[model samples]
Target: MAFPRNGLTSAAPADTRLKLKIARKWTSAEGIVAIDLTASDGAPLPAFTAGSHIDLFLPGGFTRQYSLRNDPRERHRYAIGVLREPGGRGGSAYVHDRLNVGDLIDTSRPRNAFELDETAPFSLLLAGGIGVTPILAMAYRLSSLGRDFEFHYCARSADRLAFRDEIEASAFAGKVRFHLDDGPEVQRLSLDRLLAYRPAGAHLYACGPSGFLDAVVSRAKPGWPADAVHREYFANAAPKAQSDQPFRITLASTGRSFDVASGRSIVEVLADNGIDIPVSCEQGICGTCVTRVVSGEPDHRDLVLTDRQRADHMTLCCSRALSAELILDL
Candidate 1:
């Protein structure tokens, strides 16, 4: 299955179903496990740039996205760090508890939406908790390209910091700053101070909890150009209260009508009526379920769609109709 150009896809082509053996696995930090995957036959794996992530197809019909944390320059293997989320839907738990070295797993070809802008005069990287996975890859690529950059890694504690020793020992060690929540007030990250001075042609990239990303973007929005600030959310934003209202949906292709009741989603309603929509990350973080809007206004609950995209398309999984009725391209 070919994925849309929008970047998220589930049914990839056969060749894109890259299977790799877990070459190594070890604890990287508190509640974090780092797994290295290499081609089963020891051939070079697919090449990916910094900030690229692959969809890991785990057992029990679970598919999860994990950022490649290893240096992209190395084509031999891909490394990903998994943080065990006790509250999550069980993907991380399966990775930490069941996966082992020498096991083979299927993965999608690398896809990247959080690409690094090499043209920027300077770059500031902000990471919170396990969000450092992709940012670490960017730091390595930036260092190798001799680009001007600084990385601020924030964690609840020094012990909980993943890849702390590796980062501190790297050549870019001087350019990296560690911020611990348990530290003194002066040592904690000050978003205002860090983003106070916006340099010419500088760009800011952040990933972490939704609140952390929101804080970074919120602070930078007033000073920096909208295009200069970029972020990726590792988790879905908190859901709003149970205020969903029933809405009508019209399929532009077939002129079919469906009713999406309160506490339900467009995808669910359509699927129940024998309509299939490709979807991943039903919480709306991934762009897989985006569909074009022919008419009517959308509630726009997804985090992946940009301002421009939202004008024309909406994520079908979680987003609903703001208007009484919505017409979808289907």
Candidate 2:
């Protein structure tokens, strides 16, 4: 997986799978579990950026994307923190209840849409609840680069704060602040005051629930440049696209045409026709299924893509075409 140009690794194999063994697993917080996975064959795992996440193929045919929480420079093992979501679609529940150390698991190579900007003069890291997974990695990278950064973590209570001890013990501990709803008055998060300081050319990165990210981005606006504010949403914020009209997609390569019916994604329609596109986190949170749009307007639904990128690419898993027909560079 050597790259002479861009610093990126390729797909795992023809199967698109990386077999790994759980090196360690432990409870990180009240409802969070930290896991470390190493290559099953004992080789160095592929490198990953700070905000990268891998798709974990779990029992019962469930696939979930988990953020890498360990330092990006470490290749001995990949670390991820999972918050037990009783109401989720069962991935976290299986991890907390059945997964154990030494268990062999299947996963995809690391992929990152939430990449860190190492060139920024200053960084503002914000995390709410489990959203800290990516922010924690960013903090590790920033600290290693000796880049100035301020980190703020918010949780409902002190018990829910994940990696409190580990983060505080870090070299950049002095740059971090934790806000708990039940903690002291000064420790409570005040978004207004927290976002008031707008350093020139400073970049802000945030991840968490849709509401939390929405608040942070909405508040940062008019103060921070649109391109300078980066975020990764844990859940898809946009509701299921309401348009039920069927659309046509033309492949630029074979000059083939297919009609994507309502309620079915472009990826599904293509696969049914014996065409497959690599995909993960079908909810549009990950860019695994992003495809270039040769022509036609797209009804973008993904949370990761900006208004600008929507003009050229679309996540086939969720995004659909606005025009009657879309020409895609398949």
Candidate 3:
């Protein structure tokens, strides 16, 4: 490899942490609310790309991932819109009810699991319900770049839709399309019709409830490339306990050991024994609770680790020990 003429230079490391406070809150729709945040200490914020997300550390040791709905160019603050699913899991429920206006929180610096693929000649964005969060950023970027991109925002009704007026008022007014289930049949988003309109060199990004994403996958599978289809699942069932069998954890660095109950997570067991592990996402989707595994096999249960990462290391927040006895780094 050749070095630059201005002497050896390395790329700047990405910022991976943010200390922020809830700056403002507004109800976007019937069940959705938007939360804006800013640095509590007036420090410079990190830059992020479209389709990025931040790991929010909520109270009661709960961590969840939310996409950055606001534009990434504005660095003074960040914003995210969350839907309160009453019948769903507890994360959104707590954020809607318990999170106050001035609460301080720790967030992982923006990470992009879904990125805009600019190489394509054009793009098609399909958002089901709150899945619009990530794709909205893509729409903003595409509009700014003068690219040919279209968006289909689908929801049950107009009142349930998020950012309806703002999106319609933007420059993307002509490019954006709304599909309501209660509207006329021709106005609803049709998988068959969308499939027929698929253009060459167009990437399709979809996110939403499990059923919606499943339909997209079922309809677009045989024709779409693996990289062309991007999806995120919002309807994940809470992870269950391993079994009734108990296990022992030995701290390799400190030569200390502890017993972990079958129903308890490694984080819970360690916290009970005075071990503090900094974590944000407890569902295993965020790599915040990653710890070195000294010995013994790990029973991986989290979605954060890739197949290759699971083969190498493990997440301690949700992943538990599969072996009867295991060794861990402090």
Candidates in order, TM-scores: namely: 0.87, 0.93, 0.70
Task: Kindly give the stretch of ten consecutive residues in candidate 2 with the minimal lDDT sum.
Answer: 1-10
Model 1 residue runs over 4 Å out of place are 1-16, 183-186, 241-243, 251-257, 273-275
Local accuracy of candidate 1 as per-residue lDDT tens digits, 1-330: 011122233534547699999999999899999999999999998899888888888887677888898789999998899888877777888999999999999988787767889778899999998889999999999999999999999999877889999998998999999998884532689999999999889999888887899899889988898778878787666576345889999999999999999987887788799887866667677576789999998988877777877899998888887789999997
Candidates, ranked, TM-score: 2, 1, 3
Model 1: lDDT of residue 62: 72
TM-score of 1: 0.87
Which candidate number maximizes lDDT? Answer: 2
Decide which is better by lDDT, 1 or 3: 1
lDDT of 2 by residue, 1-330 (tens): 000111112223338688899999989889899999999889999999999988777777667788998999998899998888876777888888899898999988889999899999999999999999899999999999999999999998888889999998999899999988785533777888878878988999999888989999989986888888999987775786657678999999999999999888898899899886877667677777788999998888888887677879999878887799999998
* Alpha-carbon local distance difference test for all models: 0.83, 0.84, 0.73
- Tens digits of per-residue lDDT, candidate 3, 42-97, equal 77678888888886765664556788877667787778888886764577888788
Which candidate comes out best when scored by TM-score?
2
Candidate that beats the other on TM-score, 2 or 3, i.e. the better one: 2
Q: Which stretches of candidate 3 lie over 4 Å from their true place?
A: 1-17, 183-186, 237-330
Evaluated against the true structure, the overall lDDT of model 2 is 0.84
